[model samples]
Target: MQSLQDALYNWLTIKVVCDVRPDDKAAVETRDFFEEILTAQHSVSNIETTKDDLMYYISYQQGEEIKKRRYPRELIEIMINQINQEPEKYKDYPID
Candidate 1:
């Protein structure tokens, strides 16, 4: 506890206290739920990053309408560029 206090004194941080529970049927089947794909339209789920993972999204609300830009455009563009640059490498892949 003393070590934590000393470290916190030098840096800004959030100390969360909660009882951890497994996400069972109640968590997923209930009306309130967050999907594996974070691009879903309804709620924005808070996430904790612990590794080389990233999430990108854009949202806009216009009165009664909720406009969500679901695709990760920048990432998609990078993938497209890779495929364009090496068409022969991806030639064996099937088309939709």
Candidate 2:
């Protein structure tokens, strides 16, 4: 049987990789923005960046589950707009 601590650890640790197209400066900016949000939430265990993708190893406490998905370019643009327009709204919430 697994100990409670082990189970919790497994639940908290999640790895996700995000891929973006064009590999341009804008894509880099998007990755940076997401990284800042992740760092502020204390959920990033590791981050690996490349020309076209970002690999994130995240860990959060119980009750906080990070969803793993690919973010389309349009969504990234929307996130950039939101962050620029209402940075305060995201100050308390973890990155989605």
Candidate 3:
């Protein structure tokens, strides 16, 4: 139970479906943006999206008071791309 809870808290292992159209012809641009762990047991509270990019909200346990940071969209995209390309680099990210 402890490991399961840790897995759930650390990683997002859910299959989310959306009603949208996919363009196969559209080429994906995989930029070597991030080269580190973005989901290394960090506490991610909420993620908000905007017209241009995304808003990544993550909190941290600092002694007593919880600290947080709102990362920009570019960073978020880089992190996602890194996570997707994990254990297999130089591959195009899946269009999900």
Candidate 4:
């Protein structure tokens, strides 16, 4: 089992599907993004170093619902791209 710190680190850095109408293309993109990240060399999280830094929460806010998604560290770039393309959709998010 992953620890809270592990989960938080992954959640903070991963490319999760926050808000989407559920499309195949998006799903494929997410999957591919995850795979790409998994193959990267800098997959390790420096938890000790970042313990004092400001961390952001990656979640979806639709109406009154605030859903959290657990994303892998490898998918961060893809998630950023998605957030950049859909600024309005992710207005509440700080994916920069």
Best by TM-score: 3
Candidate 4 per-residue lDDT over residues 1-96, each given as its tens digit:
444444444444442343342343554454455433433432432222121223343443334554443443344446657767886875453332
Task: Give the distance in Å from residue 70's predicted Cα in candidate 1 to where it truly belongs.
Answer: 7.2
Best-to-worst order by TM-score is 3, 2, 4, 1
Query: Which regions of candidate 1 deviate over 4 angstroms?
Result: 1-73, 92-96
Model 1 clash number: 0
Candidate 1 vs. true structure, TM-score = 0.25
CA deviation > 4 Å runs, candidate 3 = 1-53, 82-96
**Lowest-sum lDDT 10-residue window in model 4:** 44-53
Q: What is the C-alpha local distance difference test score of each model? A: 0.30, 0.37, 0.32, 0.42
- Expressed as tens digits, the lDDT of each residue in 1-96 for candidate 3 is 234233322222110001111221112211101101222323323322222345545454434545555545454455345545573643333566
Alpha-carbon RMSD of each model: 17.4, 13.0, 11.2, 13.6
Per lDDT, the best of the predicted structures is 4
Clashing residue pairs, candidate 3? none
Global CA lDDT computed for model 3: 0.32
Cα lDDT tens digits, model 1, 1-96, are 224222221111111100111232332222122222221433234332221233333343434555443333344245335645786764422222
The reply for model 4, stretches above 4 Å from the true place, is 1-9, 12-74, 93-96
By descending lDDT, how would the candidates be arranged?
A: 4, 2, 3, 1
Each candidate structure's TM-score, on Cα atoms with residue i matched to residue i, is 0.25, 0.28, 0.30, 0.26
